[model samples]
Target chain A: MTQLQGAAPLGATVVAEHGPTDPRDQRPVRGRKKVGIGKVIAWIVMVIILVITIFPFYWMLRTALSSNGALYGNSTSLLPADFSWGGFERVFGLQTVDEAIAQGGSGAKLDFWRYLLNSVVVATCVTVFQVFFSAMAAYAFSRLRWRGRNAVFGLFLLSLMVPVIFTLLPNFLLVRQLGLIDTLLGIMLPSLFMAPFAIFFLRQFFLNVPHEVEEAALVDGASKVRVFFSLIVPMSAAPIATISILTYITSWNDYFWPLMVSYTDDSRVLTVALGAFRAQSPQGGPDWAGLMAATLIAALPMIVLFALFAKRIVNSIGFTGLK
Target chain B: MAITSPGVAHSAPNGRTSVDARRRRPDDTKLALLFILPAVIGLVVFYFWPLARGIWLSFTSWDLLSPSQLIGFANYQRMFADPVFWNAVQVTLWYVVLNIGIQTIVALVIAVLMQRLTQSTFVRSLILAPFLVSNVVAALVFFWILDFQLGIGNQMLEWIGLDRIGFFTSEEWAIPTIALVNVWRHMGYTALLIFAGLQAIPANLYEAARVDGASETRMFTGITLPLLRPILGLVLIISVIGSFQVFDTVSVTTGGGPVNASRVLQVYIYENAFAQFDFGYASALSVAMLAILVVVTFFQYRITRAGQTDLN
Candidate 1:
């Protein structure tokens, strides 16, 4: 899985003692030229794959910016057709119903802003409390010594194996029984306290914390809780931030559970709302431009977060994927 | 957050001995309980309880309006005979095969290329951009881009002297198309995982191989593949598990449409529980899915030896 083919040409050059002046070095130079061709081919392949991966996002933006009316006529155009903000205006309910219909939108009141607000509220609540509580539990597992701690941690690990779908139905029922259906609290409740991954991730980091520091604090009469809150939490801020970004993204993008529980606009999130928007198209067909605009908006927060924490998020993928 | 040196009043006379004994036998049971209570409560209530209740509910007949009646293995029997469930199983397996097969190969290639070519964070971030988008967003973007009437994908096909393919509308193409859409979203993240694995393989192994004039292919197969087994096993298991539960994209794009061609098991379960209110049947189906996953995971672990490492 690694390529050291370039080393062959280098080895050839190293073996040629007289460098470029020697006839033997000419052969190595030709070999080096061949390696250059291989490098060019590899670079070409990388660029193609990069384009495939990134083009759809650019396409989303282009389509979002295009006029809905001219989309079909200019289907093959790489540039936006009839350059218009009508799609976004319709999505944000900034256009009159007549103007929306003229632009090929369904003109249905989407409550896009409300869904955005709901997503923010739900994601924030889940991320903050989940990370905080999971960190506390991780502290217990990693720092404090107690009987059956491994057993409990093992139980949490096992929970990771349980598919989310298996518990999804019952969780919905539980939330409904609590009369939190169609409320932001219901969307946030199941995830608010702790997640198995969060605890597991934090515990992994906490295990690496030096015991000497905590011991020093204990000798100074600092309570275990104080050490955790003051010393451990501060030191573990990087991992905490990583898990927080992850939890926030997951919470924000969750669709099925929210779809099950939230019926009205009052509790609907951007993901579910976008689905509803697509299905709510008029007889003329879906407002493609408007839908793309809404998708872009729904995806904006994540894209922004990714931009800000791209390195952190990309680096965390290796750690999270292994789990 | 500075821990100020406490006065003598705070540090007791026995602090030194207690610290030493604590080192010998630390028992913070009471504090541990306090720290762990919230998570324990969450686990028991949200995860463990619902799991048990879901299993129990699987054996009963209920439709939300009436009290559930214990029906023993009847729900399981119905599931066995249900054609839709069977179709869903077949569809899901096909999807898993396609999704995991294509995704793993592509990701491994990309990971290898990245390892060989450049360690550019910019390139990795660009590849991972699609994954950062929510499934709904990815689905909708693809929906519009692949739209049969005006989608640029079809237009390009036409420009290339081919017929326009109904990506989401046709029965044969829906599952494959959906799988590809998801592949686009997850391949980068998967590649990065394998790349991390690649990074862990000691460079000295490659150096020694080069010294012996081992070809790149030989080095990769002999050295890299063996050392990378644990991570490959892990990536496969994670992706397979995730692939089996393909919901968000399907839900947003096709809603398991075109004669239920894209109706994977999760969609089937969601429809049964929410649309039809057949909670018992849904629960039974979920239990079946869980059992299959457990078996699959066990076999994968055995075959891959993911728990073991070839490296010393």
Candidate 2:
């Protein structure tokens, strides 16, 4: 475990070691005269790649802001021409003109709010349970010396390669047998049990915690559980945050598992709800504006999370040896 | 970050090794068991039991409404004869190859470029942004953008005097198109992994090579490729495993349609179990997938290890 943790930070350490001499640090000032045709080509390729990557989000936002007429009509404006909040309002369950017309007399009885709430509730439960259990297991695997520790840890690691789909059916049956079908608990249960990946990642982080800190706590007569709660977890905040973010993102974005178990608005997450909404469109094609709006709503939390913790998240991903 | 330096942490072990200190404590075994119990129970109930049950289920016929009867090797025999299953296998393999092949190359190129750039944070975040978007939303975005009539993809193609392609509707293009979209969504993540690998290469080695008059191309091929072997293996393993399990995007975009062009194994399993309600056949398919995965991973390990030795 110690060796693994040591291996993990080699990249970070080398990057740090070479910081002062890195060509990147001096490139801006001295690179102008040195820019060859090759350099120019590289930059152009990079920028084009960047544009391709970022353009979809831009297009989604533009479609979200545009009226349904602009998307379907002959105008074909690339940008938002006439701004409209109809899509957003409809998603938020405020009866829009489209909804009123679509339902003929009464407004569309969309359960967007309920779906969003279910997503939130499920994602939160999965994140909390997965992280908490993973931390305990990781601490035990890394810090505690026991008879069967290596064997247990090895089994967990081996299970990491098991494709989740392999277990989906039988797990579904198990959940159904437990009478958890169509409940948020049913949707969340499969993932709420922390997987091998989380344990492995957290174990790497826990191994990095200095032995002396825990030794001191132990020497001072603090119990193992108390020491773990008070000292180990607090010191391992970066990885804890990383796991929390990852777990939350995964739980939030999960579609198939939730779709399998959840049937109604009471348990259906935003992704499944959006999928049903898009599929149930009357004719022609899906409501582009409404779909885009819902996509944005589903995507915004993750975007905001990336904006807030891009560095931390990226570093954790890079340094922890998780893909 | 501060704790990562094991060298520093190792030197000052308070003059008492952890094992020696641990010997004084007798309650540690019980405490450890307590700590690991939840995870252990979770794995048993959620993973191991289900895994065993899935294997057991493959021999039985269960349709949610009726009692399951064990008919040994029946599901596997049917699977071997099923043309749809064969088609699914072919489609899945194609998707995995294209997805991994495209993503690996693109991510490697981007990672190398990212290493040279100064404003990498902005670029990295922008590139990784799509990965955060759920598969459902990603499929929707690409669905609209790749729409035959209203899609911007076809619009741009027409502007360039090429025919508008049916991304999800046509059999020839559907699988490849979905693979491309999957690549686009995940390449950034793969790039970051490769970037970390690039960073870990000691700068002094490149400096020494440059001083010895090695060309940039030679340096990259000789030094970078060999050194990057391990992380590349990791990336390939992750990509292959992930792509093989493709379901969400396929379900949303093609519904395995236009003639089963995009029906990968997961989609096949989903349809059999949920739609057709044939739990036995689905379980058989699931077992086959698991077997294939294990074999593929073993080969991946062997090949990457072989590459490491050849490079050395």
Candidate 3:
């Protein structure tokens, strides 16, 4: 600012008259050359902090790449001495994973494949079913005027307000009655099978949709079903996608219910599988490398997904919830 | 907006066919009903049924097996009488308070820092990493970090001049440690929310304050704090709700131990339902928890809303 051609004549009286609030207070003054050195210092400090934030992720990938031999050596190497695909190979292959499991060398050999499959299955199923139910409910509540509509919506809101555990007892019993215990469905069926938050998010999105779109379709002699299927559905894709991502992540990481339901590795999701693995802690001899490797394997999927879609997730929350 | 009258609207007599079209037609009520039915039925079967059964079971004296026998509030009476029940409540209340307080303050500070690193997208994303991990993963990760033996927490303590803290072990630090882990896992996400709220406040407001010769800290107190009440209140409420229903960390880390010193309401319910097979007792405990949360949350909402109106 001081160096600008027409900015100032370098007198206190004139400078105070124009930019007296001290343009350097807090908000960065764009196009100002005087702040260049300060900005560089700030950038360096920020980069250092950013490194601290990203180091854990680097460590996870590093441990995943390290071989069993390199791991057991316990050498304090930031970079791997000998990298191998053994852990991931073992995680993905049933036979390799099975032999390891049969021996049970380091506690219970986790069938990581089974857990991953279970997680994928449960997450996909719950996300699909939950989105369908919530969209329907939200559309109905928001658009349809029927007997006891407000009352029913009130019940939905009340249910949302309460902690979900209030209904856990009944849900457990219901699942038990249906013979779903120890099944993938059992873990996925509780909070999600009917999620109020989904309904809430979806309805808000649906309400923001225009009445004219459907009315215009109807005016053109288009059937209601055709209109909804064609227009409303396409328009609401963003909210539905948001709900799907949120629901999938939630179902992916669900713990206690799965722990209570699944008796063995065949039925357990990654969360419970990892949990049971950690429970059988190698107390006497700590296998830090293996434990870290296993944790990385279980955690990698969600971390990658989150990193890629973080902006979408945050913006999605702002979008879906605000309406 | 709508003039709904079934009588004297139209008569489908001879030559009244076209005339009927002139009268008001039925609204798109049927389509709306169709839209809402899927969610309604799902909730009814999965949520409402279970909720009713749970509430009813609170009055019965039954276990996992056999039909529930009505016992006229015996479970509630017992819950009220038991000292352990109160202990769990106290710990839970403390957990809720401490978790909300610490998380709110830290999240606010972090949000402020994040806003400062406006030019750095990596730092913003970095701050949000822990939030991306699920609650269980966060708890498990922290559990590993706080492991008494080879844990990073203890390692850090050794690196520092201080003695090792028993984090999730010794009765004294167990609950607080759980709270800290909870905060660490959640702070990034909460801070992200608060940071959004802060960013949404127009830059011109702060500039105006600055032009009025307000100091940075004063501008924060007068402008930022006043504007951030809604988001802060939300963070406070949600954190409280999350803490009240806390079961994952208690189960994974301490096993509610050093003698259930860190036991929360959910854990208490878990023990009753699973260990004792006292589903009736568990139901009663859950109902009590529901009532307490509703009352507390309602009060908090009212308080915050009232403060907002008063400030206005």
- Please, what are the lDDT tens digits per residue for candidate 2 over residues B9-104? 233444567764657556578989988988998888888889999999999998989899999999999999999999999999999989899999
Residue A151 local lDDT, model 1: 95
Chain A vs. true chain A, TM-score per model, equals: 0.88, 0.86, 0.77
Q: Return the TM-score for each candidate structure.
A: 0.91, 0.91, 0.83
Place model 1 in a CAPRI quality band. Answer: acceptable
Which ten residues in a row are the worst by lDDT in model 1 chain A?
A11-20
CAPRI class of candidate 2:
acceptable
List candidate 2 segments past 4 Å from native: A1-33, A96-108, A319-323, B1-15, B18-23, B306-312
The lDDT leader among the candidates is 1
Q: Please, what's the RMSD in Å of model 2?
A: 4.6
Residue pairs that clash (backbone atoms under 3 angstroms), model 3: A140-B36
lDDT of 2 at A318: 60
Report RMSD (Å) for each prediction in the order shown.
8.5, 4.6, 9.4
Worst 10 residues of 3 chain A by lDDT: A11-20
Cand. 1 Cα-lDDT: 0.83
Off by over 4 Å in 1: A1-35, B1-27
